[model samples]
Target chain A: MSALLEVEGLVKHYHVRGGGGLFGAPVVLKAVDGVSFAIPAGRTLGLVGESGCGKSTTARLVLGTLARDDGQVMFDGEPVGSVRDARWRSQRRAMQMVYQDPLSALDRRLTVGKQVMEPALVHGLGAAAERHEKALSIMDAVGLSSRFFDRYPHELSGGQRQRVVLARALILSPKLLVCDEPISALDVSIQAQVINLLVDLQEKFSLTYLFISHDLKVVRQVAHEVAVMYLGRVVERGDPEALFHAPAHPYTQALVGAIPTPRTRGRARAALQGDPPSPINTPPGCSFHPRCPRAEARCRSEAPLLRPLDDGRFAACHFPVLSTPAREAA
Target chain B: MTVPLIELKDLTVDFPVGGNWVRALHGVSLTIRRGEALGLVGESGSGKSVTWLAATKLLPAKARIDGEVLLDGKPIQGLTRDQMAGVRGKRVALIFQDPTSSLNPVHRVGTQIAESVRLHRGFDAAAARAEAKRLLDRVHIPSAARRLDDYPHELSGGTNQRVMIAMALAGEPDLLVADEPTTALDVTIQAQILDLLAEMRRETGMALVLISHDLGIVADITDRVAVMYAGRIVEEAPVDALFDDPRHPYTQGLLAALPDVAGPRRRLTAIPGQVPNPAALPPGCAFAPRCPAAISGCVTAIPSLDAVAADRRTACFRAGHATPWEIAA
Candidate 1:
């Protein structure tokens, strides 16, 4: 499958305030610094990171909602800077997004059926009767009853509202779906239902996905491949099973270890000493060196670029872990 | 092993909404032993938070509470407002979910913690500040004294949570009620905070009543677990047994819906309905509408928690013989 969406050397920076007044020195926070990735058709690539690591910014950039300081976002083998171009406009129907908070994403004044039909109407897909029929079908597909067609947002539960939001996104039948923490705001039982629905929808439609979330467990369950982001860079990328079982980078190692598992009790963990450094005025070398457990002298001055390993995994650390032994291999 | 730290019998809390009363808790009874962590697991609007809040006398003015809240077998129901205030800060401390909103934005974190200490313990300003720093140090906040001077806005979310925990501990309360304490934090910080809570529980022997929506989190630190649905405890059991063999239909549904942390790709089984609204709850078992094993009989009557096994309680009519546990592979 050819790449449906490719983000090449993407860079996004925000000019933030310093301690002093307007005359004080200006500070730049590199929210998404040279982050690169690609999503092929019918595949799910999970972007996993803590909050403030620029994962959301990268999503915004891919969705063309944010202006990049420097970089390229190629949609359908074409750049995406000026979306008004006919090529971009035609390809726009091929992409859609499902936001995390359905309460904020949906318009309260509109009915569920109207919300789902908006995309169909925007693309001039069909007539009013046909669009209404399609909206009801979409709602049913997402597990929303037809009774909710006239209900407002306040009348529905969080799960039902999210399903309405999902129905709206799927109405266009986009090839690529950008899900930004779509299940985080949901209850656990509801979360499982939504995730299962997404999986089923993906299988039915053969949709590619850029799944952005901070939940490692959820990512492991759904993602075909995974990318670990830190301080606005992809620190590691590999198959979900391999990376989660025995992560390569120390930061990944710390992250996987820090997760509280129900199977075991009170396992020892290498607690990160301090919080991540400020995005503004990042360290000279590795942006993570300040909080890295295995930082060396060279790490202080040299940033490591992502390099492919023997097993087709990519890691951006000078000292990647030795290959997992037979016993530890998942 | 001896007298439980906190006990509630026939606890009921009702909120006045327009003119009618919305029952948040319905005749719920529970106990927390000293140094024990009791996990209260439920979906949203399940009344897990309301139960504990009423036990600690922290409910808002609109709530009318009825029950016997026994702290070491001492009834605190009829205590005056001043006496209840004394019970709230000194005897039972609360650590809220959102640390950002819980702490005052303008005050220094140390001063906020010191204020709690001063309000309950009556320490002088200097001594309270010193105690506040010590509490922060105990919660593993680095450079506690210097960091205490920083305002809430200047601290990170995780640090602010640590400061909240420090404030909760400043009064040396016998019971700590942490309501979704780590929900707003990242996973790494969440792990650190859980570790801190575990360590504090061991050292101080303070009974902890933890309210959260995550089953895995409650399973990690809690000794026993209570599953709440709509406003009642549907199932209560030892941690291992609850996971190994959940009896109630709702409990089984929750377990089946949870993604197995260690497994290949599989479709999760989900219960097919939304949680019933608290305002207009169903007449019978609240979970009957969503329970997979719900029979015709279940919809006609509310089930009381019955002893299914040693120290295990389940409220479903078809609990033990009706619902069989399935471990996700």
Candidate 2:
């Protein structure tokens, strides 16, 4: 199957001020150092990580919101050099993004109907009457009431506002959606509802997703394949089923372990020490070596490339967790 | 042998909305023994925060709080503003979700900790400063004496959280209410913060009321667990019993809704619909709209918390049994 979206050798760096010597030097924070992945047509790739891990940066790069320093972003076998490309404008309709904070994403002054129909108008889909009808249909599809059309962003609840955002994204009928922690801002009770709506819509529309989120549990629910990123790099990538069952990278293992389980109580977890190292002046070789529990001499000097294991899972690690009968028995 | 360190009986907190009272909490009762950790697990708008705030008499004037909230067998409901202020940190300390926001940006970390000690314990400048340094050390903030002068923004997220914990511990309160304390920190840091709370709980024997949405964290640290849906406690039991065999349909749905890391790749079953608005709750059961095991009787009859098993209580029409999703085919 042909890949819907392909990103390779992606790099993004932010110019951060201060913190060098007596006089602060301009430090370049390497947000997305060298990340690469692909999302197949009609499938979801879950990018899982902690806060400040460059998952957001990578998403911005894919969405063309943030420019990459050097890389290739191929969409439907065509290279996307810049958003300025007239062809890219047409392709924009095939791609849409759902932000984390729906309130911030929406224009509070505009009504819910206007917000949903604006995308359609921007794309020059149809006439005013047709656009209004299309917006209402999309709202109904996402489980929003028609009564919400005339209401402003502030008038609706968190869940209702998020549904409006989904309606907007779906108005374009995009083949791929870049959902950056879309449900994180919601309450738990509402989170499930929004997730279910997304699932139902995905099946209905045959959509592909680049779902970026900090919550591993939610990511597990929505994603078919999983990619674990650490310090602006894809540390591990594999099938969600295999990755969760037998995480390869130590970071992935720690992340998987850190998740609160319902079955057990106070199981001794091997917690990592200290915050992640500064991305501006990262250590030589493995960026995670400083906090990695199994860090050895080789890990310090030699950066391990993401290598595919025997089971087709890829992990960048000097010492991946040994998968034995005992480990799998859990 | 003695009364629980902190007890809340028949507590109800109501907020004035558009001229009428919106009941946030309804006749909730709970107790926490000294040194024991009680986990209050619920989704958003479940009144977990409001329950603690009202119990501590920390609610604003607009919020109407009724029922008994006692600390060391003394009623705290009708205390004067000054008396309530005196009781707040000295008897019951609160640690909020975002540590950075809680800390004063302009003031140094040491000054904040020292101020709490000075105000509550009436310590002098030097004594309070020394006590602040010691409190920081207790919470595992390295180089406690030096970091005292550091501003809140100067410290890392984890270090700032330590400052929050240090401030909460300075008064040496008998009961600590940590509301989503680890939600802001990274997962590894979250684990560490939880460990720090456990360590402090062991040492001080201070009763803890941990309010969080994360079931895994609650299950890890707490002894007893209370599951809240809308504004009512649907189920309350020992942590193991609740996780092993959840009685309430909402509780069962919540557990099943969680994407199990160890389970097979299956569709996660979510409880339908969002949490009903606090101002406009359903007449009978607040959770009836979302309950998968909801019956016709559930719509009109509000289920009181009844004992379904040994030492377990559930507020559901079908108690003492599993929901359809939980039952094995």
Candidate 3:
């Protein structure tokens, strides 16, 4: 299977002024230190992590909207070029990103139909009438009615607005769609409606998704493969079912357990302790060691590398959980 | 038996819209016992927050409220502003979703907490400040002494919420109304805050009302759960009972809507259509338009919240074996 998109050793660093004013001190913020992932054609890759764990940064890097300090991003067997390159602009139509906030993503002044056609209009794909026809057809595909064609963003509900966003992204018929917390802003019932729509659209359009969300449940449902990131690094990557059933990395275990499921009261104690450390001054050795339940003496000074387990899953932990017999061989 | 710590009887609220009144809460009746952990689950504009806001008389003066709010079986609805002030923060502290915006940014975290202490406890500046430090420590904010002088912006979101909880605790209220308190924090931090709230409840024996849209959190934490929709509570039951056997169609739909984190994967059974506009609500049950179990009578007559069992109550007319329960009632 050929990967529609492949990212390796992605790193983006930012220089920030430490706590105090101008002359206080210069600090390095490694927003996305080193991340790697690949999404096969028509399959989804879920990126799960806490805020400031560089999930969003990784999304932008994959799309080339943000310049990377060092890395390689390959899309459809070709290395993606810098933002200034002509090839980058040409390839932009093949990749689309759906943002978290639908209200902010759409322009309030424009009609929903106008907004849907904006991407095609910007790319100079067709005549005005052709774009209009294309926009209405795309709207129908995303479950939006013709009555909403003239309606402004404010006129629509959160779910409808999200459909507009999805319609706009799909108008160009991109191979890879990057959705970052797409349903987080919606209500629960509305969230279900959108999720179901996403699934239907994925099948109909044969779209490959790089789905980024902090919600483990939603991710588990939508993604075939999942990557668990902590402090700008991938801690574990494997099949969502296998990985979530019993996580190898301690951080992954803690994250999976932390979600408040609806069935029953989980363990009395919180699986993980404390909060994620500041990305600017991340802890030495393993970034998760401070909050890790199975931290040892060596974990304090030596960072772990992401290596494949016996079941084809990768985990960046020295003492990965040995719940499965096959894992001992790793 | 001792009277419940707080009770709201037939509470109703309406806000005047462009020419008509939009009813936000419709005859909400609920009670909270001493040291009870109650969960209020609902979608946006579902009246979960409005129930408390109206009960506490925190809604704006323009909004009309009709209800009886009782504290220890004593009607507090007729209390004067000065008396009501005592009920609000001193007797029932409130924390909102966004801790950063809820707090006064210019004020130091400690100063805000100390002011709350001074207002509620009538403590001197020194005593209030000292108590503020202790409260912060209780909420598990690290380096409590150093964080005292830091502005709300200087602290992380999780730390600021800890300060808010500390400030809420300054009143030492019998009931703490946390409205989506951990919604803004990260998953790990959310866990920490939930653990903190649970620990505090165990230690202090204070009742808590957790208002959130997240069913998972509500199911995990609360002893009892109330599921609301379109300004009405469609179902109320013991936490386990509600999860085990939901009666209302809306309640069932909500549970079905949630994608499972573990176990088998299944297609989501999302409810059809959007929540009806509150101002132009249907003459019948507000949920009938989207309910799959809706019957012919559902369009013509409203369903009152009827007792389904000794411990469970539902507003749906077709709530499992509704005919038998109707005769029993």
Candidate 4:
């Protein structure tokens, strides 16, 4: 199957005033630097990273909400150069995004039903009666009752509000959905409900998803493939089951080991130390060298490029774990 | 058992909303032995936090608390405000989830720590500053003395949480209550904080009451665990037993709902409905509507917590029968 979305060499930087003086140079913070990935049609690509790891920035760039400093984004075999282009406007109808906070994403003044139907109205897809019917059907699919149609956002619970958000996003019948921490704000039981809904919706609609989240468990459940990001770069990418079970990169190993599992109690594992270094002054060579447990002198001078392994996985590490003997012998 | 360090007997808290009172806690009873780590696991509005807040007399004046709270075998429920203040920092220290908001933003983190030391330990200004540095060092903050002078904003969330731990440690209290202490932290940072808390408990032999919604976290840290649903704890057992064979339907559902990292991909057994509203809880067992194993009798009568084994207690109508595990198999 052809890829639904392809991002190449995506870069976004922010300039801020330095501490020198009035004539001081501005510091360039590379929020997303040289990141590239692709999501096949009807599949999910999970992006897992820490808080400042630029996963959200990549989402914004893909959605054209934030202008990229440099890169090419190909959607449906068409290169998107500018957001203002007529093609970009029409392409947006095939892409929709769900945010982390449902309340903030929704307007309190508008009723839940109207909010869900607004997308259809904006795209001028149908008349008022048709839009209303579409909204009700979508809401029903997301497990929201018709009674919630006239209720304000505050009247609904957190789970109900999120269903409304999902209903709104799905109302557009977008082929690609960019969900950013969609269930992080929910309770455990409710989080499971939403995750199950996303899975069922994906199967029913054959949707493509670029799921960005910090929760490893939820990501493992929904993602066909996973990408581990560190300081605005994809350090590793592979099948979720393979990547999680036998992580190649040291960073990926640490992340997989750090998740608190109920089965393992009092089992000790090496944890990555210290907070991520400031994005404003990313370290030389590998940006993750400061916290990498197996950093060598070579890692400090030469940056490691992401290379494919024999198992069809990619990792950017000078000495990746579990390498084949032939490569090590070389 | 040598008079438990802290014991809460049938504690209930009610808050007025609109015209009627909402029962936030429906007679919660728990006991923490000296140096024991008891995990309280529950969803939002499940009374895990309220149980501690009411026990410590930290709730707002509008809240009406009933039942008994004993600290060191002494009644703490009837204590006056002045007397309760003495019990707060000196005997029991409470740490919240968000350390950034809990710490005073304007003051240097050192000054905040020093103030707590001075208030609880009766130390002089110079002594308090020295003790603050020591406490920061104890929590593994790098360059403890230098970080003491930095404001809250200057530190990362993990570091700010360390400062909160430092302040909580300033009192050298016998019991530490940490409510979702690592919820806002990154997974790696969360591991660091959990390790620090475990180390502190080991060193000080201080009893810990860890309240969190994450079952995995609770299993990793606590010796015993309590599963709370609605406004009451449905099950209580040693952490291993609770994870291995959960008796209550809610507890079983919660464990089954979690997506496993090591296991094969499968559909999650999500609980059907949301948590019941505290203000208008249904009669009898509040969890009946969502309980897969609920019976007709469960809808008319509340199940009291009954001992199922040596140290396990479950509040289910069919606790002794084959549980959800057997049913699923």
DockQ of each two-chain model? 0.55, 0.59, 0.52, 0.55
Residue-wise C-alpha lDDT for candidate 4, range A230-265, written one tens digit per residue = 989999999987788888998888887787878666
lDDT for each residue of candidate 2 in A1-330, tens digit (9 for 90 to 100): 879999999999888876746578888898998888999988999998887789998988887767889998998888766666778787788889999999999998999999999999988999999999999899999999899999999988888899999899999989999999999898765787788788899999999999999888788888988999888889999988778767888888878777677754667777777777777888887889988988999999998899998888899997887573112424
For model 1 chain B, the run of ten residues with the poorest summed lDDT = B320-329
For model 2, the stretches where C-alpha displacement exceeds 4 angstroms are A20-23, A145-151, A324-330, B326-329
Residue range with the least summed lDDT across 10 consecutive positions in model 4 chain A: A321-330
DockQ of candidate 1 (2 decimals) = 0.55
Q: List, residue by residue over B161-214, the lDDT tens digit for candidate 3.
A: 898999999999999999999999888788888988988899889999999999
Q: Give the runs in model 4 whose Cα sits over 4 Å from its true position.
A: A19-25, A323-330, B325-329
Question: What is the TM-score of candidate 1?
Answer: 0.96
Clashes of 3: 0
lDDT of 2: 0.86
Error of 3 at B183 (Å): 0.4
**What's the residue-level lDDT of A231 in candidate 2?**
85
Candidate 1, A125: how far from true, in Å? Answer: 2.6
**Candidate 2 lDDT, B199-304, residue by residue in tens:** 8999998888999998989998999999988878889999999998888888888876776576665566666677888888887899888776777988898999
Query: Which is the winner by DockQ between candidate 2 and candidate 4?
Result: 2
Q: Which candidate order results from sorting by lDDT in descending order?
A: 4, 3, 2, 1
Per-residue lDDT tens digits for candidate 1, residues A1-330, read 679889899999988777776776788888999999988889899999999899999988887767888889888787887456777666678778889999999999998888899989989999999999999998988888899999898888898888988898889988888999999999988888889888988998889899999988888878988999998899999998778777888888777777765544445666666777877878988888888878899889999999998788999998887575211332
Clashing pairs for predicted structure model 2, backbone only: none
User: Which candidate number would show the highest lDDT if scored against the true structure?
Assistant: 4
